[model samples]
Target: MNYNREDELKFRFNQFIISKVTGENKDYYSKLTIEDFVDIKNTLSNINNIITYKTTISFMDWLRDHFSYVDENYEVYLKDVLKVKPSVNGYDIMVTGKVNIVAEIKCNKPINNGFKYGSAQKNGIIKDIQGLLEGKTKVNFNPIHAYKFLVMYDFGEHSLKATEHLIKNIPSGYRGKVEIYNDKTQLKIDKVYVVFIK
Candidate 1:
């Protein structure tokens, strides 16, 4: 059967629990009900959520710490790691990589109010790009690279249209590219790669 990442993780977690329980009480395995498995799945989901949230938070801190020092070219000691800093009120994860390519990384899941062409998402991204261009937003480090928007989500038709709207609205000079990524794509965290050019 086909399994997503979450499903695989839950299955492995359940197997581990089952093995431990069977070791302690062999009869317990036979006594387990569907409800018990459901509970285990829910618990694993919650744990995964917590871990993902923490890891996201830690990534920003890690970027800051790792790129704290730079040589004359402002490149991080780790050649592939991009320089990052906080952005405006709504935008987050500003990264500057090789050749002064500056990008705003926006991450969203596929469900619920994921990144779309909604007013909030559109305006927020526009504002961030405008702010960066106008030098209104305060950044820890300045990037001499081109501007870009790095969107991490499973794009739908609406999302594609929204991205197009965003790209069209940006000022001519700062309009660089919009990179899209989903579960199927292999994202390399070590280096900043441009996926599309505006």
Candidate 2:
């Protein structure tokens, strides 16, 4: 059969939305908006590296699709576009050829029924932090700019808690250099940051 992934994704999104929105008055519709629905829908597709936003999800798309209110101060970096696709060229998103404005995207469900991140999940997140701080690519990373995002697909409260917990174990060496948010952190132009999306 000739398969069209975009059509399939749209079907899945519609089904998911229908299941979610069918129950009752949208006033209490999971307390989320239409944009939230689309974000979550695309997030699943993007994580799977499907049509719209792939694992190789680009700066253009990320900027256009997601909004970060990770902190009030982070307003400066919010939605600004980079001319090139940094993450596509490398493993994850980077604002420049150097280590300015890096990002790690995670589309994981909070493990063990949303209580927290499992051991493997924690380790994977740590690895992303590691790669962001120290680029795994052939080129050496020297963070010359600000902001590093650990973008988590908002999978409800459990996922939020899990993300907060992940920040606690940032391997000390990176503890000083980077500014990651559990609840909040002082925004800096010289440090990588974190943002959550769904």
Candidate 3:
């Protein structure tokens, strides 16, 4: 199985994500040679199905076991959640799944964000989840379908656990609670899908 596209895309995305996360606002594209991206794209165009599956699983497992989420909030404001976005979206990851089921990628690292002590920055994540939940609950989207939360963490298990706690406690107004996914249960995540790439 060959995962050249996946690998190349991730390599590019890593450069992009890290720059954004660390306030390195320089244009990364300017530094790249056409041959580099072409190679990655060609690799993806010829991606093998077996490689795709194996690579995806391996990537997820590495993420789960190797990194831990640390707190880092971005300056972007999410109006729906009425708070600044967390740094999770800017991590060295790229997510590709159905937009409807996929929420933002997050890091499960600890920080001194305003909301809670050493908790994952809750602003954007909560907002997106809540918005989706409200949309489903009010039949804005489709209430009949069970609402799900897909939290993709970068580093720590603590933030992952914190997300699980918040999700489990979604207000009574909504008919569903947040469901967390790991390697063991990721296959079961047919409802709402989230992919975290790094």
Candidate 4:
């Protein structure tokens, strides 16, 4: 099936996953023809949906480790801290226990073959940032102390573009004191860590 270098690599990787899984292949990826990839690519939702879902799952796995609290109230505390469900505030994840945390997952693949954001994507990022840092919500939640995050999915080498975009376009109120790509593991406004997981 007419293959380019990239397609060949992906096909080989898919084969490897199926082979090494040892039993049942949990991967949703099938032995796709080049034509099939092209078809799926045309419907961006097909790809984005998968990426977003997988990213969320992976992030949650990491987060559970990060929190490392066996307490069931971590769930209740997470919501009580937020005073609203994620669906209400459009947050992707929130956890409260040893430390409060709120994150927005962005599984957007870069457009223009680089990191430039489409209008809607840009708007969404800005909104999430405002919501995270500025506490834009009807709820009584104060996000100032929480670890705010904009967890972006990097497809290939697009993450740097995200870093660059954020640096250039940090919301006005936070622009003067923003820190990024420093020795510090997190971005922040003063001492408060606003982690940008790229």
Candidate 5:
């Protein structure tokens, strides 16, 4: 899709206004006149590029903070570390316990840019599921069962539809099941989670 810088700025500005007007500092910003708000929004739009980077970083930080507690009630292993092996790619976070779960966290800027459903991204997820089904992916801990998950920062309908298409198009020989967890409020971020289980 073509990128419109002005439209992007306006969207970011609206997000900023919503956040501030509904946040702890709402009293201060909400009291400002519409003209003052527009002025502030314009000033912010001028530095939207720089603020964009900051917003991305902040989103990632928020993800880390929330996902860190995924296994709060369980005895988690490899909580904050990445596990790598010579055979398969590394995982961002591995939660090993009664129900072993390997998670790959992905942060995409703007959240609205959506995910690309090309071979690279689609095959990457497929390959991970394939590896898990074939016992090619390795983890430090052992459990009776395990699952693979791709946790990405995306809420756009296009991205979600693309993921659904990817799941439906998986080769028939694949034995595992792919499921999406769309209501993981614990994460507290706009995210789409795809899971594969054997």
Candidate 6:
């Protein structure tokens, strides 16, 4: 999509008003006044390559390294840090390239659940990105810049199959590449749409 700087600035202004009137600090720009925040959003709107495959992959690795395992978790997944503050929260990975791509991660079982919620989380992350893009938040997160949700499931052959599926399904609009982590190797599987979306 072609990003218009002026339109984004106007939208951010409106967003600021809404936050002030409704008393919602949820806008990423709630920390800054409308007048002061417009420039930040406009600057980011111009950044098109902020989200990239290498950067996103690096961010995911960082995410895995930053947080520690905890007792409050499930057999399949464990969230050491449920949220990241300041810029974004509730996302699996957050990275800054020329711009930024915030990704959320989810997993599912191939047979029983069939990666249902995992997909939902991806959608939720997209919705969140959309909201930020539309200036619904005081500060625009530039969801349109480039973003993705990871739905990872299965650990063995199924994982490979799922990765294959992901290679096929990733939308063309996604700016970055989709990667799959196998036993000890990480492959840049850009063609398939079915890696275990976790």
**RMSD per prediction, one decimal?**
10.9, 11.3, 16.9, 7.0, 11.4, 17.0
TM-score of model number 4: 0.58
* lDDT, candidate 6, 1-198, per-residue tens: 899986686678667767766665454443567776677778767443233223334445544453333112222232222333324444444344443444543333344434323575445434543343332455434444533335343355655554456445645654344455335643232311122432
- Scored by CA lDDT, what does every candidate get? 0.44, 0.57, 0.42, 0.60, 0.50, 0.43
lDDT of 1 by residue, 1-198 (tens): 775886675566557656765544233434558898788678776653354334434444444443443233333323333322222342234444442334444432223545345666566556555544443444554432433334333245545555656566655665543334333644343223222211
Off by over 4 Å in 4: 1-49, 70-88, 176-198
- Model 2 spans with C-alpha error above 4 angstroms: 1-47, 51-89, 97-99, 176-186
Top model number, lDDT: 4
**Model 3 Cα lDDT, one tens digit per residue, 1-198:** 767875686567767657756656555555668898798678666444333333334444444353232011111112222222322232122222222222334443445432232433555566555554444332334322332434454335545555556656655643244565556654332343343443
The true-structure Cα RMSD of candidate 2 reads 11.3
Instruction: Using lDDT, rank the candidates from best to worst.
Output: 4, 2, 5, 1, 6, 3
Question: Number of the top candidate by TM-score?
Answer: 4
RMSD of 3: 16.9
Better of 1 and 5 by TM-score: 5
Summed backbone clashes in each candidate are 2, 3, 9, 0, 0, 27
**Model 3 Cα displacement at 2 (Å)?**
58
Worst window of 10 by summed lDDT in candidate 2:
66-75
TM-score of each: 0.37, 0.52, 0.34, 0.58, 0.45, 0.31
List ranges where model 6 is wrong by over 4 Å.
1-90, 96-101, 112-139, 143-154, 169-198
